[model samples]
Target: MQLQILEVILWPKAAGLPPRRVPFEPGKVNVISGASKRGKSSVIPIVDYCLGSRLCAIPAGTIREACAWFGIRVQTSEGEKIFARREPGKQQSTDEMMLLEDSVLDVPTDTPKKNTTRQAVKHLLDRLAGLSNLGFDPEEPRSGFQGRPSFRDTLAFCFQPQNIVANPDVLYFRADTNEHREKVRTIFPYVLGATTAERLAKKWELENLLRELRRKERERAAHDTVSATWLANLQVWVTEARELGLLRGDALEATEETLIVALEKVLAAGEEGNGFSAQGTGASADEYAALQTEESKIVLDLSVARHRLNQITAVRGTVGYYKGALDSQAARLGVSRWLRTLSNDGARCPICDSAMTSSSGELEQLCDALATIENETHTVSMAPPVLDRDLVDVKSKLSLLEDQLKAVRIRKRAIESRSKAIREGEQTSARVARFLGRVEQALELFSARSAPGGLNEELEKLNDSIEDLRKSLSEQQYALKLDAATARVSKDITRIAAKLDVERKDAPARLDIKELTVGVRDDAGREDFLWHLGSGANWLSYHVAAILALHVFFLRQLHSPVPALIIFDQPSQVYFPQRLTRPTAQSEEDDIGDEDVASIRRFFEAMGKLAAHFKGKLQIIVLDHAGPDVWDQLEAVSLAEEWRGNDYLVPKDWLDILE
Candidate 1:
């Protein structure tokens, strides 16, 4: 499925440039080369752009910016020719863009000779190269700057400098990229299996895990805020209770011992002032009076101390009771009641346990005691005016904590919901994983066998059968409609990959490449070349090898009607000319090495094999800055035969050169 360019005609009114004619000689390489910017690369876009590749690398300018106003008359098979041309800013008129002739009109319509150039071109691609209808638009003719099919599909793999290597966003198969692994797996399903799909499934699982962890964190934060708020209010209550003599601080201290010792002295003074039961002389009136006053003071101090101890006990009891109640509340609400409490009742029935029971009578008693303590505490805290300030402070703290708790609960719910979604996602992911694995395995098998099953065609056929059966049975089938259009295109590609494997082996490899990845070791226990030699030879081998592999893949797997043309904008980049010791007087020297020439010869030999495979239907356009030697090799192969077609040199004056 090769396309040979016949003649390119430029319309006078189309732009202003004279029509350029380039011929296609059979088996010959049309070497269009000249000084830099002499429209060497421009020739490619000119042909491609006319054949429905809209963004043909030609800059968007006037006629001068384009490769030049050109009309391309391309011959497919037989005498049929497709005439296509484009102006700078007008739509390509369809009247001048259709098939012109047919050779075997009498034959069956399916025969290649009977078809138009357009149809023939499509047939050659589909039958020989296994290509199908390229993404060419039959309607809505292309206006200048109109979007067309992707350049890769339409342009037939042009290797311009911009696409020399690969980039992340560019979805092309590169040897070093992971995508290549998928390609190889698709091509050699027996070896790689469906690993690429499995990798994607793993990514989905990781996403689920992250979602679950976030849920638990939010729950924990809410619990902390609730606990903090409860503790802060308790501290204020304790302080107020202490001030009202309802509670005491530091019960175990030496200050209490001093007070006790002073009380004992006061008792002794009272005994002395009483004069030992009116018998022995004791004290004067002034001493007796002082002793009585001291006695009264000690009694008052003892009473106050007792009151403080009782109040302290009450406050302690109240706090313990409230804490117990909170624990019960939290337990009912599904909070962690065991937190910070070693004696958390372990699954004990509160009704059975006397100590645990929240009896109404006990609750009332505790409430009354709390109220009394609250009243005393509030009085001590207040300045004899409003108790509302202290109540407001407590209320404010509670409100803030409540708000914090509410927010935390909201966050917790959100997290929990997300976690649930993640769990569901995980389940879905698992199902997806299983599905993908099956698909991958199926793809691998499909690739290995090149059978229709991998294409999921059988599934599609089954669905179609089901629909037909349902239509006949009830005249209305809802379930069948859903599954009827679920054909997997990727699977079809895998099936095709498998089918093409038969031709891949023993397909002539590029002979010029230095590195031949072949098999079997030599007598020296080292691998021997199928045909190896030196460095220059190896370079050519690599180049030819690459081209050969691509050629095989393109012919066997690509299913499109576009012309199979390998346009190398700068092939010399790979096949460098030999260095000369003596400076040649000629501006351009012809000194390609013998090894280089031999490698090139190998490439040609490989080409011969491809031509045989393709039946002389391959078009290779090499645009380089070469001397006569390159043409000499091309001529030796009888590639320069007159019937070959045409060639047009883009004179220096035609285009502006970019330095």
Candidate 2:
């Protein structure tokens, strides 16, 4: 992608004064060099603000007080786009902005309300830069929350403010925060064509898939542990129940339903032969028998209700499992259909190397299969509601049976108390029968607690899915080839540094891909890095060389997404003794000394040379306090009229336009 700043316009707060405009040329060094406080440094911030910066970084003073809006015109691959942002009020930023599709030379005279938002403008710019589809979740495991590259993120490489241009620790503009620094490090290779957007996305996908795989492994381990414990307990319970004569010998081979039925029979037999004469309790033996029979009927009803409740629960679980399986099948079928469509449109089949034939019969078959899966999923989904209704009815019936059983138990306890006073002979048989009944109920509960059906099959299917994902991840790992790219970037930075004649034994000699820092060789033949280098001159030199070299690398690549522009603010700061407070034109005879003059000239000369070497493929903009004499002799350098005496980004006439 290519971007050239054609102009920067500052709209006045009132209609009487004209908007201030600064024009720039493409593929050349455009220097806005002159005195202090002439808004020379504000250009970079204005460009950044117009580009979708969340906060307006323009210093609060005369410029902010006078200008109603800030705008910029840039020529891109998609033609010229003009972006205008309202002057931030008291807030840190504003979303309101004006966007035009044409090259706007002047700000509109009418009071133009915001027609778009900052995000909308960024989307258009992202499209021009071929980054519309280039985004990934920053929270992915390996990604470390280094957010995806935005147009502004790339601009951090292109623009260097005075505060950052001379800082020894920082290299890129506004990269003071750790998060911003990580974003620069993570996105540098990608912008240089060492990695692609697709590869980056796939890398994140693989990381997520691996995380999910580990989760499934943990889930399977937990299930196995629980299942083993359940099986062991069931076996012990069954053995004890059989020894107690609560279950018959054939009971060990019984299913859940048969076990429940056996428990019911044992419970019924426990109720028989409770010896009590009605005469002693002032009731007849017939009354006692009738009461026992009623009690037996209620117990049977309670047992049946509990069995029905268990069956309803089991059915609900089965239906839920089937529904989930059908839903997964439907999702896979949809993906397959999408892949087939892509294949028909000239994409190669992923499974086979040959061109995919668009067979109508095959397509029809897939469609039919998809339809069947969808129908099955819908059918299974509906079963949950019916099962829920059945569960509610079963619970209601269980509650009613429980109430009846509670009443019968109360009456039997009272009768037994009275019978105990009359007779105690039948107590032994009754006690044995009750113990057998209790044992049978325990066995039935154990059977119900066994492992769920089809667990192993489900685990096998998940394992197959993980294997397929791993295979796909392996195929897409080609995007991580950063070694060769690092070498190329390192070489380019070294070559550019040499061209600029940055003289320090510890100057940058290589670019580190992982740390995103420049490496240098020391006098001891040991390698050092840029952050350890001393002096503001060396810092400025290394910063400029690294940025220019990266742009050069981008120009050489056929698919690089970096814009071909680099903006520098006061790179000649080291040459100046103190901050220049007033506008003073410098000549060759100025007392600035020869070394300072030479260094300034060399900086501009190197920039001009690189711009010429690229042959209209790169644009360089410099903002400084140097006069025309510093760069008048340089070739292909366009010097804007000095911002010293009367010239400035915001005109003097418009200074009083603030309402």
Candidate 3:
């Protein structure tokens, strides 16, 4: 991460006046030496505000009033990036920002518009620093800080402000507050190479696996929870499958395992086309309708045939009856023929041979009347020849009709019987279908519960994975490496402190993670906190030592996420509280006293040593009131800005608009 500040740009509020650009060089101690009220201390906050800080803490006076937009150009691995933020007025901060990126960036001659947001810039910066995209809390970033490390979190090591430069209570820049302290603590191991990116990723994986393990374990437990009830239902299901003919060889064993096998067999039977689906009555609606219609037509045809037969038989029987009556009369009238013969014998009784003439005439008359009656009765044709022929045709038709009617009656009975059977079979089929459906449902449930690749297997796998990840990600797992990293940083701190020669410089100095401050331990391992072991000079030197040591360690790591740039604002403030006029050839800092001059010299020298150690891999920016005489002999230092009478972060000409 080589995000070295190229320049701090302040576009003036007055129209048509070009922005003032304060240029800084890379990988060197770029110093901004100026007097008090020259906007030297404001440089840190101005740079922070431009780099996406939420607060506009750029000294709400001349610097804030004179500048319309605050911007910083920094060099990153992706080349130069310009991050400019509009000054927040009557507000803590604004999200409005403008971000520009290219291989080479120049300070804009005209004021740029807010083309992006502070959050967008922060993400760009985070990625530039090799920070992970998973840095934000899923629920809320402000909730617990389990999120990935942010670019701002690393800034706690990057900036050492005036108030923070000598504050022994806090080692990291923003560790004074709880929110910042915890965030820095969380990310320190990552920046120090103790916790690798692989470890963080594995930690996340472990949490997910643990959640999955819990859920699967619950499901496996649920299977146990309902095992007995399901077994009871399984027995019932097996019995149904057999009764529905979905299963074969039907005596139910009713044991749980056997019932499961039975269900599987039933499903197999369904697949083999022997299921209850094949147990239908095989009755068709069209067949039923056709049979019913034929039955009705046959019944009607039978009724018509019977009626025609009755009519023809009645006519024939009547003719025969009349003829028979006539025949009987004619037979009885045969006595008339005998009477006629008797009349012809002279009206004498058949029993007497002789008769009188008068008696014979009277008998003859009676005989004639009787004979006429016999003749008329005997001559009446019971059936004429034509009628007889018609009757014969009628009898033939009647015989044929009787045969047809008999056949129709037989067919109608058959249809009715078949229809009755179909209706009964359909009723039975409906019941069987419904029972089969229930059996299918029960079998599904049974198979799911008794499945082979069950929840227990998945749960076991998840537990195994969780155990592995837990081991890999545990803090104790990285304890030795972390301790080694801390030890190295502490050793550097002790060496750097020795040069500055602060109190307890000979003692072992260590960064107390829990205390979040530097601790110097004497023999018994008891120590004075940096806050307690302090004069102003002591606090300042220790602060510088701790910060520079951390940076050295950061540069040593192959893939440290901390920005390679560290900015110290007004580091010479404790030494030169009033100010130092830029020295000329005749006079070099006439204001300097013997009081702690060597300490300040050693202070810059330790910084110069680290700068020389990691030449091109690191950048150090100092905004101070120290003159050229104070740090000119050091070749590692570069002059970034030399603020004089009216020139500052905000020029005097830029402030005329506010006045």
Candidate 4:
């Protein structure tokens, strides 16, 4: 797809400063190169922010504060469109953006805010760029990204920020984050026409199905761990109930439902009293009532005796505790007496390690406390024997009550035994019926705990389905297509690298498609990849060539969804320092050497050749500190005046504008 930025406009918040507009033409390398801090690097972020970047990456200073809105005019297959995003406020940028379907030649004095959201603009861009809305599930929960590929995802290849342009470890913008790197990897094959939208969707669906299947299998395994014990208990209960004739079935062969039915039958038999007679040899009602009354009186007497015994036992324990405490107190009193004697003889205080004197009053008080403890201990010792006597009496009373209660209960049980025989036989059906109800509930719970028999079968079917889809995907020849595309991109990179005269032995032959990198064969014959190339010049050259090659590959494919625009922010940094005030003259001490100058010239020459090769389809924008002299021989436009003196991408006058 063809996509080019026609112009980038920064609207002033106040009327005093006019809008700043940087214009561009198609089929040429547009260089916004000048001195440092002249808003040369800000262009990439401004255009990216207008293109629906989540955060407003524009620096938070005079330029951002002065601008009310950031806008970009782009030419796509859907014709010219202008997108404007309001400058983020102190709090945050609003989701809303302004969009004009037609060409925007000049900044509008009164552009009205519209209800179009950032998401809507993204969707529109996706459509205009011919990107398929291919949906997919995240590899795991809370991965922070899901759904279809967006136009913003494609920008990883198109835009190179200053931090990444010369960074060897990074290949794409914002790829510093793992998630962004994953997104780039996932969309790389699709963006290059190596895989179809349908195939990608199916692959994601199969992956989700497999994840679900594994989750269900884990649940089944967990259930099995607990269900074994439940099943064992169920079998034991079934056997016991069967032996008691509460369940009338062969428990071994019975299903849960059958066991439930047998249990119900047993309960019904209990309710009907199927095997008992009403008449039996038992005591009369008068005798039984007289025994019950006698048992009640004995029980009350036994309870009173036990309560008194408990109180005596508690008193004995307290007396023993007090006796031990009194003994300890006596020993302490002896120690105090010794200390007092020592103090009177001019001894040091043991506690404070100072000269001490024992007062007569204090000694007397200690003597009184010791005497009291002695008296209390003597009294407590006397009480224990009394408590023992009381305990003896209570125990005697308790023994008599137990004997009476036992005699009565024995007689009562003899009478109850005859009656119970008759009642139990008569009520067997009812008892069994209740037991059956309980067993039925237990069986239901057991069945619930058991894993569903179809779970494994269903999982197998899913696996089979996934396998079939995999086979179908394989039949689509993704690997072959990807290999072919990689070869083409590698060839293009080799050609571009050679044209730039990058110093590397066998650079073309060392391009590894699987690794997505180019290597340099050293004197030791060891291959060093782009990330390990050390020098900033080699890093910058490799990135420029690789990125341009991928774009070239995309342009050659009729159905590739990537846009035909490349934005490079400071590709000249490898040749000059970041803090360079301006382009240096030939005689300057810090001037770029001839070799570096020729490399920069060749870089622009390669860009021009690629632009012409694509027949006015590709757009290249370079934001750097290079002068017009470096690019004057090539068909490149230099926005040098825009960065001259106080003028910048956002004009100096605009900095004074405030809302």
lDDT for predicted candidate 4 compared with the true structure: 0.70
| Better model by lDDT: candidate 1 vs candidate 4 | 4
Can you write out model 1's per-residue Cα lDDT over 432-495, one digit (the tens) per residue? 3243233223222323223553224433443554455334434133223322211122222223
Name the runs in model 1 displaced over 4 angstroms.
12-18, 59-68, 89-544, 550-562, 575-609, 612-615, 631-648, 651-659
Q: Summarize candidate 4's per-residue lDDT along 483-589 as a digit string, tens digits.
A: 77777887877777777656763455344544545666677778778787778877888888889988888876644567789999888777754433344554655
TM-score of 3: 0.69
Error of 3 at 249 (Å): 12
Give residue 38's error in model 3 in angstroms: 1.1
What lDDT score goes with residue 548 in model 2? 82
What's model 1's TM-score? 0.34
The RMSD (Cα, Å) of candidate 3 is 51.6
TM-score for each candidate, following the candidate numbering: 0.34, 0.63, 0.69, 0.60
- Candidate ranking (lDDT, best to worst): 3, 4, 2, 1
- Per-candidate RMSD, Å: 37.0, 16.2, 51.6, 37.0
Rank by TM-score, highest first. 3, 2, 4, 1
